[model samples]
Target: MTGDHEPLPPGGRELPALDGGLPLIGHGIPFFRDPVGFLARVHSSRGEAVAFSLPGRRMASFCGPQANALILGLQDDTEVDRHLFYDPLLAPLLGPGVGLTAPSELMKWQHSLLLPLLRRDALTRHIPVMFDEVERYVAPWDGHGTFDLLAVMRDLSARIAACCLIGPRFGRTMGPALPRLLGRLEAALFAFAVIGPRGPLPHGLADRARETLVHAIKEIAPRDCPEGSERSHFEELMRATGPGGSSLDEDTAAALMVNWLFAAVPTTALAAWTGVLVLQHPQWLPVLRAEQEAAFADYPPTTLSALHKLERLSHCLLEAERLHPPIVVLPRPAARDLNIHGYRVPRGYVVCASPGLSHRLTSVFRRPEAFDPDRYLPDRAEHRTTPQALIGFGGGRHPCLGATLAQQTIKVIWSALLRAFDFELADPEVREARTTVMRLPRRPCTVRYRRRKR
Candidate 1:
């Protein structure tokens, strides 16, 4: 409704729905109640693409690596339109021809504008920003203390995201409020996807949150760095132009920043879960510490090169991401008719894939559910076999834009934690990660820590 995409012609074969459902409402109630659990059950039974039991909508749920590749790649092309799915939920937030809700050409343009921030050398320098954030974050845990790892990591992730992505000055001045504001908008995509656009949503709350961030974004005065000086991703977006040198409007630019921060805040799930998993598997601490010592000896832990040398720690982070992916289901709309995995998928039907489900396939992962970082190691590299095998950060051409930043943030935080203190779980209970928004621990992952004697 928000974008200028064409309407679907009402003449396509209906996809088969998942079993066990009420009469009229179908499986809407259960699907809304737990999107990930419902999808897991669906993935278990269905071969590739299976329809969810919701009555009004026709969504084809795809599982496994092949399915993930098919949908994530095909959904944005000729037959499928990415905007049709995103615009309903996100149009109100990102607007037309901007970021996720934009058409292919426009989306690519906006992406190109943002790409300068992720340049190789630029990302290398960002490690210190993350390290500094983590250093200040865990400083309060003096001699001994107990705290919720998830909560602590979320706050720390927000600070790093603000400082590194938004701008160092703005992050310091206005960083504290980004989490609460951005949190309101985090669930909009999936909530709207499952419940439908007309379904119950805190429209007023999200609107207010978006406006507050936009207001803050607009406050910063534009500065000229002359020629080759550095600029934050926020500043880059603020000055960047779109098609034919046409500058993005103020709200559009703010929407782009909002999108970036959205990825940073709640999706800090990776950094948070990485800490939780390492704590849960205390056996790996020595291995991580040894690698840390070696890495730091060569190039101080503050540098990006040092973090890159932490291959084992990085693998653990990847394993944690594999086990607890940020988002459960990725769904997109078909603008025109297409065939998916031998099924005749009609135009307007939504096609979806679950990173949570796909990542846990026994065929794909050895000891799928366990914290086995060696799965990514050279000897038993299970994830390397398939194209979209490890889809925690998406696959095909639409991989997560912030995947590198998320990984760097995790590295910096964990390296700092491992070096500065000794941590032990307050409650030695290991909670399994679930398929849901953020995919972090619902219950408290509390831990006790003491300042390490250097």
Candidate 2:
């Protein structure tokens, strides 16, 4: 019951500790294999705050509402420099100028510059492009052959990231190569995280991919940008200045693009999971369709006003994220000593919160393991009681800036897809995979799509 500054009472339990890690690798294997289960087990057996080791460093897993709020809602004592955790994985690709690694003032400036793109007016303007991208990507699905649903969604997302965020010309110019390049970049980043730059093949591929991205950015430099209505993020980057009034250089521009892609690609990947979960819960299909029908009775739900009416779709997505968040762990480096639920956490310690574990806690959620959008209903509002219960997009000082766009993009794409076709999972028992970072749905998760007979 004591505040963060208050000292622990005499003999009060210290942060519950859990350790059985391998000699050198520490808990890497177990932590990666079943991160959700591992954290949950530790929290249940140990306590709200459980300390564990991972490879080279000791870490603490903050669980339940009290610990989760403490970790996520940390103020004045902790900060999210991507270097804290993402450095080993993405720093090579994203560089240091992005919001991920930049200082507070720099990050604030970056966020302010990027805010206009994600605003309601901008998203509304960008809807046609999003719809076009989604429709064009799905046009070939004919409801005939089974396709990897996640793969399709990922590719589509990459294209949308290019088309809407960068420019349609860039998207089309890159064509299929953009996603392939992105795939290679992501794989290489993951590999680097696992083994360092050991293998020649992956390292070479990553190098080449980075070179290609840099070249692409230089090729499309603002001077080369076509006049008229080609909305390009590259141009935006060129025009934007830091807090010190310096325009983005090639490295910073390219890094910002990569960072933006990192934010976008994963959320869009989760769109596929949303589809899979909804297909598994067939009962919701009719409900979603009905809601869409009512919401867009007068016109298609592509506009900002129209998109707002699709309440049920939003609920379903919220529930899906609660059950299977893409970014499971939110890591922050303590900038100063801190007290969390009375546990003394020192500066430089990697304090973490897990949406993957917290979302499934029986204490906060009624039936944590179940898929129930009703938990967010007006009457229920389960997340209202907790400070940071639903952190699929993170929280605290620096939440995901693109979160609103991510949800809208997913909703728009799925709305169009569901209206156009009926989806049947090739394997109902398919599960989500943990690929070192995101909680992705299984590869080769196929689905049969049949065009809606209107």
Candidate 3:
């Protein structure tokens, strides 16, 4: 906790902070071992805003609704940079231009072009594609058998996201190569702590993956005038910006796609599996099933528009996000010196905001730990107390661009599954995957599926 002392801001709060353990490691052990429990304990004892030292770096964690808002609001500040954490893992996959590392101007431009595709009109256009993909993915499930839902979700989402990002043909053409690319990328990320820029093992795998990714990118790259272009977002982005109306080069595009995979794949899988896990709860299943039945009765069961009407299902997903946020801790580096609750945060220090901890504050959510979807209903609107309190998709200028897409995809898959089969968890005590930063399921979440009685 060694740093230059400065006077606290007037009328600001000063609080106790954690001095992390050991040299080099800092609080990495406790953080990775039991992140949720560790954070919860810290908040209980230290209050909402606390500071900690990790490997000579000082960090302040904001755990309440107020802190969440402040951190997210800072996203648009030229001083606040997201690249510190995002660049290392995403650069090789999504290219430098697509992820946080891309120049801020390019990121803004890309966002503008891509926003329409995710808007209501574009979402409407894509619904049929989503439903068709969902039906295809679930077609193989037997009514009386058990299967791993996690694997099912990963494959399904990768394919669906591929369809949305590139096009149906590109998704199909690249199918055989997708898994290997994903595996290599995942391994590289896991090995990142040990792998230096010149490290033999990490560099070797990254190089190979980059080659495959580049080839795939070229295959999907735009050739003709970008009308009804599935890859138009990328082409239009290039054509409308920078030198020759283009900015991100091939490698950057590849890296950005890789970053997109990291962003979209695991989170989508976890959200889908979490929905399934929630459905397995005997009490909630009946209510959810009833909602599904009613939503389907009024409109065709297979369309996206119909699924949008399933407000109860949306609430269930929201509740799941609240209870088990896929990324429990959102880490951002300070772009400039700033004061949070009177505590001085110097530039380069990493600041953390934990949704897993903040979402449980009873101050904002009644029975915060309970899985009560009704709490999110418009009338209750408990989360409206603070914008930061309900940031499942994050907040501010850098908030997840794919949030709507992720939500829509999850709802579509769940709706299809519930309509087709009755399911339950194969194991009662199956735990979620908890790494230092990301939280997901450990393996294929097995569930027994039986035909629903019509």
TM-scores, all models, native as reference: 0.89, 0.91, 0.87
Cα lDDT for residue 97, candidate 2: 52
What's the ranking of the predictions by lDDT, best on top? Answer: 2, 1, 3
Error of 1 at 117 (Å): 1.1
User: Residue 70 error for model 1, in Å?
Assistant: 2.0
lDDT per residue for candidate 3 within 1-454, as digits (tens), equals 1123232332344546676466765775666666778888877788777776543355678788767766766643444667766676556534556646667777776556567667886776676677777777667666599887666776667767767765576566677467557656666655553232335686667778867766776667454222265545456545555534666665555555555555555555456546665755667777777877777764335456677777877887888788777676777787776676456676776777887787888989999867788897889988886777777777754578888888887877776777778888887555666531345566666878897776
Q: Which portions of model 1 show Cα errors greater than 4 Å?
A: 1-15, 22-25, 75-77, 94-96, 187-194, 199-201, 221-235, 298-302, 430-436
Each prediction's total of clashing residue pairs, residues at least 3 apart in sequence or on different chains, is: 0, 1, 13
On TM-score, the candidate that comes out on top is 2
Per-residue lDDT of model 1, residues 230-338, tens digit only: 6545566667766778777777787777777777754567877787788888899999999888888643344667778899998998888788887767777777676
TM-score of 3: 0.87
Off by over 4 Å in 2: 1-13, 76-82, 196-205, 221-231
User: What Cα-based lDDT does every candidate model obtain?
Assistant: 0.72, 0.74, 0.67
